[model samples]
Target: MSESVAGREAGSGIPARRLWLATTLILLIFVLLLAAYLLLRKPTEVTVPAPVAAVPAPDPAFATRVRQLEELNRSLEAEIARLGRDPSPLACPPGTARRAEARPPQTPAIA
Candidate 1:
């Protein structure tokens, strides 16, 4: 019984030593594979776009049209202001005048 116990204590250290060696070998293989992948990987490329040119000035004809529209807008605003002050109803058109004589009220006819 004493020899068997002694043999177990002696053999216990051999399995612990084998486990430590296996763990170290696995770690070394993982590190070598990671280093090889990083070394063989291709670098990314970046492209730069060209700068845009400055915008050209507006045309003279467009400037003249804009000024004419602004003047017309001012005149219409003045006419609206004059109408607001007077508050007069607009004149009826020539063809749609109301009749001068009032018609007598007609009672409903008997059936």
Candidate 2:
């Protein structure tokens, strides 16, 4: 009975030893290909830009304009600081009350 079973297994399917050998061979080929690719690949190269020549001097007019703009900016900042310190509402100036008193009174609106 054991002989019959062994014979049946042999005829019916591939042997375990043959399957293992075939799997090992395929894996070895893959590993060898990976190793070859790694060894034969070209190294990456980095290129740097050339240094620029001496920069040209800035335009005199541009320097003057920059100075003017800086002065304007400082004046604006000072104005902003002064306004920030004033507690009065911007909608009404200090002389608005005298103007309102001089104007004739208007009749109340009917609801």
Q: Which has the greatest TM-score?
A: 2
- For candidate 1, what is the lDDT? 0.92
TM-score of 1: 0.39
Worst 10 residues of 1 by lDDT: 87-96
True-vs-predicted CA distance for residue 7, candidate 2, Å: 22
Which runs of model 2 end up more than 4 angstroms from their true locations? Answer: 1-36, 39-50, 89-111
lDDT of 1 by residue, 1-111 (tens): 999999999999999999999999999999999999999999899998999999889999999999999999999999999998885676666776767696755999999
lDDT (C-alpha, whole model) for all candidates: 0.92, 0.88
lDDT of 1 at 60: 98
True-structure RMSD for candidate 2: 8.6
Show model 1 residue runs off by greater than 4 Å. Answer: 48-111
Q: Estimate each model's TM-score.
A: 0.39, 0.45
